[model samples]
Target: MQRRTRQQLRISLLIVAIAAGLGAVFGLAIAGAGDGDGETRAYARAALRGVWTGGLIAGLLTAWEYIYVNRPAGLWVRRLTFLGNVGVRSLIYLAAIMLSIWSGATVFSIEGADPFGWNAQTVIQVGFSVLFSIGVNFAMAINGLLGQAVFLNFLTGRYHRPVVENRVLLFADLVGSTAIAERIGDLGFHGFLNDVYRDLSAPVIELGGVIHKYVGDEMIVSWPDTAAGRSRALQCGIEFHALLAAAEARYKNTHGAAPALRIGIHAGPVVIGEMGDVRQEIVFLGDAMNTASRLVDMCRTLGRPLLVSEALRDAEPSEDGPALEPMGETGVRGKTRPVAVYAPAP
Candidate 1:
């Protein structure tokens, strides 16, 4: 299966699992509160019913999102104003929740229970489900606002305090960005950059790299400092190049020019920490980032699309990888020592 498909499936399963677990706990609590004669049996039945209902709701919602809302073809949906999007999703969720509750009641109803009853319990259940759906929508919005890695890190408190850790950093800058922006105006350039970034994101996600940030026309991608990380980073660069090439025609037809990237990679220890007050961000600080940026700048002089620092080249296992042609050591600004670099052999 393709990496993106696998990723989607994994996420869908995780969502269902979490939903099922939470539903089961809520079921048990509800059952305990009732004065039932067969309390144990009632609890067991409620938990089982909860699992089915929760899993069904989550599965259906996830499928809809992956199939429509999250795809590029969903531009109409995406272009909706914030309030418009929320209103639409709210109605959709309400419909889905009602359907889930009806289905669950039909399947799990006791002999005397009225599946279509309009009782206090039914009202409470629907109200709770609506609240839950709203909460889920809010969480999804937050996750979309913050990239996945940053959002997860924030939740886990992974970088609450500064810590030094080795990481492989890749800097990818758009080629001829200034000329492109001048040719197509600022607004057009902004749309073009969005398209380019959308195309670039797949390779990074598939190769297990986290996008640190986008600086103007440049994107910073990072991976853990390990043999596997180095290998993935190298592979990601190649894949990124291929992606841009594949989309060249589409880009030219849409925006009058196709974008290209000059990538530079390096590996070293960097301080990772959460910074800011009202608007917090996870920041990476170290020489590695600066060196990578400088290397990308050098790409213009060297006329290479991609450049790898000697450190990164040495760290990555080359047996099954592309051959690197040595580019003699070159001086990069802000560093006293000349950094040796290599380009992937043509």
Candidate 2:
């Protein structure tokens, strides 16, 4: 399966599992708090009901998100302002919560009590559901704000202390960005950059690369230094070009200019850790990053659209992949020794 599809499926399964687990815990608590009649039976029944209800609600919401609400470009509601979109989604979620509660009570209740009755039991259930939904939504919004990899690392404290690890870094810079910005006004150029970045995100996600940062018109993406990572980094470069080509018509039609990019890939060890006090963030420091940046700068001078260092090229030598043509040893700005660079044959 495509990586993007696989990612979505993984997230869906995780959501369901977590929701079901929380549901069971809440059920047990609710049962324990009730009057001491058939306590054992009540706990068992409540737990089962909670599992079923949680799973059902989670599954339904996941489907809605992946299929209609969060689908590619999504519905017209997605184009609405941020607050407007949030308002619409909140209404929909409230309705879903009410429906789920009513249906679950009807199916599981033995006394046949009025599901719409605003009793303490009903009030508590609705309150819990609303609070849980709010917490989940808030987490998701934070995840979107922080890139997936960064958020996960922060959650697990993976990079709390400095760690040395090998990683493949790909630097992609928009070619002739200054000219494009000049042609289009500043505001128009900002929109153009947004469009370009949006288009570039797909290939990176599909290749399982984490976007490290954006420097003006350049985007830096990283992957663990494994055979798979090396291969995907190279493939991502090719795919990046293809994507820009595919979007050429749209870009030209919309902004009167088609965008192009120059990419550079390199691999080596780097020190990674969370840094800063108020504006804290995970940062990578090493020659690998510097080398990768130098390679990208070399692209403009060497007139190559894509450049790969000898380290990366030698790491993943594939017979089926595009041939790498040697560009001869060249001295980069900061390095005293000349670096060996190669270009992917067209």
Q: What clash count does candidate 2 reach?
A: 0
- Per-residue lDDT, model 2, residue 82, is 56
Model 2 misplaced regions, further than 4 Å: 36-44, 75-89, 112-116, 314-321
Candidate 2, 204-283: lDDT as tens digits: 88788899887899998999999889888988898889898998899999988898999999999999999999998889
lDDT of 2 at 108: 74
Question: In candidate 1, which residue pairs clash?
Answer: none
How many clashes in each structure? 0, 0
lDDT (CA) per prediction: 0.83, 0.81
Candidate maximizing lDDT: 1
CA shift of 114, model 2, Å: 6.8
- Global lDDT for candidate 1? 0.83
TM-score of 1: 0.89
Question: Candidates' TM-scores?
Answer: 0.89, 0.88
Candidate 2: pairs in clash: none
Superposed by TM-score, candidate 2 places the C-alpha of residue 257 at a distance from the truth, in angstroms, of 1.4
